[model samples]
Target: MNYNGLFTHKLDALKEQGSYRHFLEVNKSAQHFPNFYYTNEEGVKRSAINWCSNDYLCMSTHEDVIAKLSFVSHRSGTGSSGTRNISGTTIYHRELENTLSNWHKKEAALLFNGAYQANTTTLKTLGKHIDNLVFISDECNHASIIEGIKSSGNEKRIFKHNDLIHLEEILQGINIDQPKIIVFESVYSMMGTIAPIKKIVALAKKYNALTYVDEVHAVGLYGNSGAGIVEQEHLEQEIDIVNGTLSKAIGVFGGYIAASNILIDFIRSFGTGFIFTTSLPPAVCAAATKSIQLIQRDDSLRKKFHENVLLLRKRMEENALPFSVNDSHITRIHIGNATQCKQLADDLLKIQGVYLQPINFPTVPIGNECLRIIVTSRHEPKHINHLVFSLKKLIYGDDTHNREIFSALSVADVENEA
Candidate 1:
């Protein structure tokens, strides 16, 4: 039936559209982070500065985090070996969940393979059991949340990104007694915009709707205790479901949902994504727990992380770089062309020894492709300056076309569109 030809045809189309995914192969020595060894196209291995790592505090590579991980691996070994219903639940698992619950001020917490699974499983389970359950989501919500809502096979409405008026309009149309959930991310990862949680919460209260917030990118980076945007906004108890990933700011591997005891139990009992799947490795969970503990114990890392964010933002502005206008750690340089986006990323890595993955279609719309530069506590000022210098050399020096496209994306208009 020429199945191979059919598969190739679709992949070929993606390549032509410059939307095909490409992964960078590199490894970072734990002690020396934001700097990693990557082989260039010429096969010569060179040290490169990392600009897009989700490890905001560099906790994953922290000596203490690694120490705990090693200690736990020696004590309990790796892999949980079974799903939670069977034998996967360990002391590490229980403690991490407990820590997460307390950190978010929720009555209970349930672990999932990743935040992706946590969202999909919980929403799908709720929809399956509740009658006339509908999901009202933000237009710019992460793919995981959207997939979760759609997988539930329930009616869904998407309000424009951060458009409280539109969200309220949708809520007003729904029956007062209907079971409704407003699903959104606390931090829109692409544009680095924050949701108006207070406004959203007020709307939810008025409409008798529950709030489900995905705090994957916010956890371990925001709030007094690093509980994420909800905690930062003092809306911890108000959010019905708070899904977070240990893989991001916590600098570990896994995801969990913090919620009321009844909701947690309900999802744990009926969520296929959580039930049948094997749990996270005990060592990883232990490491994640340790990382969070470290974060809560001190604000030094968070302070330094914000300092870097400010430095990067100031440099981008001083240089008149075309970037999204948002006061967040995420520094997005709007390039607006998929082909040029990939080319710019390629050039930066090959010519400048800086790694910033090209965020393209699906991750961001085609014309909205950008270089989502993320700053961490580990990034030095020299690295930041060099990154700006290299970007200027490639984007403004010789590439007139690149400059024109970026010039059109004025900071005001870019922020408005996003």
Candidate 2:
């Protein structure tokens, strides 16, 4: 067969397996919330209530943040034009780092373009310092960490998801004197489950290992002043390095690692991700600074966001929708097969005007297909009601719970059908 024919055959296989993805064009007015009206192929405008975005706090289009962005853009132009080690280190970059260090209660902070680079650089760089660097990572850690660990050429031990006993057992098996790093996330992005940070920190102490926490999802959304899981659990002192991002909660784009001054200095001098990449533009840094200030000064937004989460979760539970048990703003509704998950998302969008992108492998495992719904403070009660109604219609063909143990359906079951 011809090479093109073979490639086409592979594409057809993906479609048959329910893994082929297509992008939908949106051409309409934008809004503050993820939900917006978009023009379809026929130039027809339709309203879509988006549930797939990572904008947890709905600060992306805030007036204050936008104003700062505008002001900084006027002053600093469009881009940084050079790497941070060269000319990209602007006053805005310095200010953002200082603000972040203060927010997380760390001695120093270093900024990266995003969390992916932050994790990759930190993990890979740390691997070089220790004689024998051992990584104990959670099985469900983000792909960024996975790639970082892989590149480091270090011996990695993956613990079962949220299983303290397994994690402890692995630590116990490792040589106590070897330099070890326990890498994990405060709040997992896909699963929406929070790590047992306190317990993990305790284990780190017992094993004399460094605790590197990726608070990408939890930062600017948890704690009294949006410090993240370490602050929320009062384990800030215990955690050695706290990695976070400004894109999600702070309503901007960038990533940072907060730690002791010595550690920050070491990474700053050696980490290629930071040294080679151009620093974030002055406008983004300004917007992030303003956003952090807002999150710190105002507690009402956090409260409202939490309440919205509770309301949405309650509605889902009342409707007998299949979901995970982890407590956070992320509410994942499990739909067994990848095809069914995509179909459900598509049907809800077209029929009910509710929009959620279907999460399939390898973002998730093969069988654990889900529709991850993120609720924000800006979402009204009616939005939750519509989501519940649409989900009920799609999942059960009616609002009836005749299926047994919706949570028990394994990834294998879905994959087998596919």
Highest-scoring model, lDDT = 1
Model 2 residue 332 lDDT score: 77
lDDT of 2 by residue, 73-154 (tens): 9988979988987889999999999999999999999999998999999999998776699999999999999998988899
Error of 1 at 301 (Å): 0.4
By how many angstroms RMSD does model 2 differ from the true structure? Answer: 3.6
| Steric clash pairs (candidate 2) | 367-411
Off by over 4 Å in 2: 1-13, 26-34, 41-43, 398-418
* Clashes per candidate (backbone, < 3 Å): 0, 1
Point out where model 1 deviates above 4 Å. Answer: 399-401
Candidate 1 accuracy as lDDT: 0.89
**lDDT of each structure?**
0.89, 0.85
